[model samples]
Target: MLLAIDCGNTNTVFSIWDGTRFLATWRTSTEHQRTADQYYVWLSTLMEFLGIKAEITDVIVSSTVPRVVFNLRVLADRYFNTRAMVVGKPDCELPVDVRVDLGTNVGPDRLVNTVAGFDLYGGDLIVVDFGTATTFDVVAADGAYEGGVIAPGVNLSLEALHQAAAALPHVDITKPQRVVGTNTVACMQSGIFWGYVGLVREICARIKAERDRPMRIISTGGLAPLFQQAEDLFDDWREDLTMHGLTVIHRYNTHKDFRQ
Candidate 1:
């Protein structure tokens, strides 16, 4: 079985993938302070509960937080006896060309999304990921990763508003019943929800205008379904897009036939 770990700013997801299918998946908070031993204990306990005893022969990781990579590497080596293929490292092989400025450190998660997007749907495309920061990544028709936009995520924006203002409290983001909110909570919800809809549409429009071609938009992340329902912008929403991409990259790297 292959272990695929995707570490985001807020959370880290671990999944076991057999050659043909995903067996079990787990999610945990991404903490840089944790040690390899600690990770092993937690993972083993989870496996015990689930009755999963598959041996992990290979591992692939896509981490947004670089600090967490060290711990993840330690976990792979100490417990699994494998050196994980950490994306964004010089040694990690990618399936797509990244067309960006020199010395630009593109996040591994974004690149993985691009690779998966290209593999699933070929063409001029934009991936809107609702992560810690809502990112817009452009994938060219030939699968080259073009530069893109990054804007404040809804939760970040809401937190900033609440932190800066004494009267405002941190809001639980949800789908608003109406755009014209009457209560303070309702008003905040409207702004956070509908506001993102407008932001996504405007950026997508600009990208389409600049590219001057038909565009396909894909949405991913935990909050994708929430916003995707508010607007008709996203062509597809795959919650496990990152896992799909990681699996592809792993096969490409480990299998000589795939690499060729």
Candidate 2:
């Protein structure tokens, strides 16, 4: 079994992969100070409740927050008896190429998403991930990550709006009843929902124009489905794209001949 950890800014997810398919997945708030013992206890409790008896032999991690990697590494080493393969580290060989400017350190999550997107959907793709920050990652025909854009996430934008204005209250993102909202909450929701729809449409259009090729757009992360429901913003919505990528990278590293 493989323990794949995806550590984002807001959350950390653990997925159990038993070679052929994923057995179970668990998510928790990201905390850098969590210890190995704490992690094992929490994980053990969850597995026990779910009745999933998985012996995590191999571990792969993709962490956006660098601070949490240490505890995760310790968890794999001390508890699982294997060194965790951390993405962006030299030791963890990526199956695909990352084409970016000189000295530009690409985010590990973006790299993982690129690999997963290429493996699942093939090349000439754009993966729009709605994480702490909404990111657009362009993938070349041969699965090379050619840099893309980044923008404020929906939740981040909402938080900022509330913090900046005294009158504005913090609100959740949802599809507005109409383009024009009748109330304060509805108005905020309208701006966020419709604004993102336009943003996605425009960004994808410009990216396609710049690339001058037929490309498919893939949306991932928690908020993807919500946005997709409002409009055809993405060709596909993959909730487990990052987790799937970790499994693919693990396989590639373990077996040299492993292909997408």
Candidate 3:
């Protein structure tokens, strides 16, 4: 079995892949200070409760938060007794091409998403990920990554608004009853919700026009379903896209015969 760990800015997810299919997945907040023992305890307890008996032999990690990598590496080495293959590291070997300016270090999460999107959906595509920072990644027909856009995430935007303004409270993002809000919370929710719908629509439109080609839009991340439900923004939404990518990358590294 392979242990795929995707550590994002806000949360970290663990999925157990048994070659043909995934068996279990768990999520927790990302904390750089968490130790290897703590990880084992939590994971073992959950696995025991779920009656999962598969042994984790290989570990693959895709981490946006670099600080958390060290402890995760320790977790794999100390507990699983295997070295963890981290995305973006030279030896990890990706199955896609990354086209960007020289000396530019693209985020591993974006790269993983690009690879996963191209593998699942064929050609010219725009992958919108709503993580700690909502990002737009453009993928070429040949599975190459072309840079796109980055905007403040809905939660981040709301936090900024609350902090920057006096009298405005931190409001959760939700679809408003109507465009025009009758209360302060409703107004904030409308701005965060409709504002993002417009942001995603406009950005995708501009990207498609600039590329001058038809591109399929794929939405991923926790907030993807929310926006996708509100409007006709994305063609598809895969909540576990990153986890799936980690599995693909792991297969490529171990087998060295990745099919597309």
Q: Which pairs clash in the backbone of model 2?
A: none
User: Which lDDT value does model 1 have at 241?
Assistant: 85
Can you give the TM-score per candidate against the true fold? 0.97, 0.98, 0.98
User: lDDT tens digits, residues 58-167, model 3?
Assistant: 99999989999999999999999999999999999888888999999899999999989988997699999999999999999898999999999889999999999998
lDDT of 1: 0.90
Clashing pairs counted in every model? 0, 0, 0
The most accurate candidate by TM-score is 2
Residues 1-260 of candidate 2: C-alpha lDDT, one tens digit per residue: 99999999999999999988999999999999999999999999999999999988999999999999999999999999999999999989999998898999999999999999999999999999999999999999999999999999999988988999999999999988898989988999898888988998999999999999999999999999999987888999999999999998999999988777
Candidate 3 global lDDT? 0.93
- Residue 189: error of model 1 in Å? 0.6
Q: How far is 180's C-alpha from truth in model 1 (Å)?
A: 1.7
Candidates by lDDT, descending order: 2, 3, 1
Score residue 118 of candidate 1 by CA lDDT. 86
Q: Could you say which candidate leads in lDDT?
A: 2
Off by over 4 Å in 1: none
lDDT of each: 0.90, 0.94, 0.93
Q: What's the lDDT for residue 73 in model 2?
A: 92
Residue 113 of model 2: what lDDT? Answer: 96
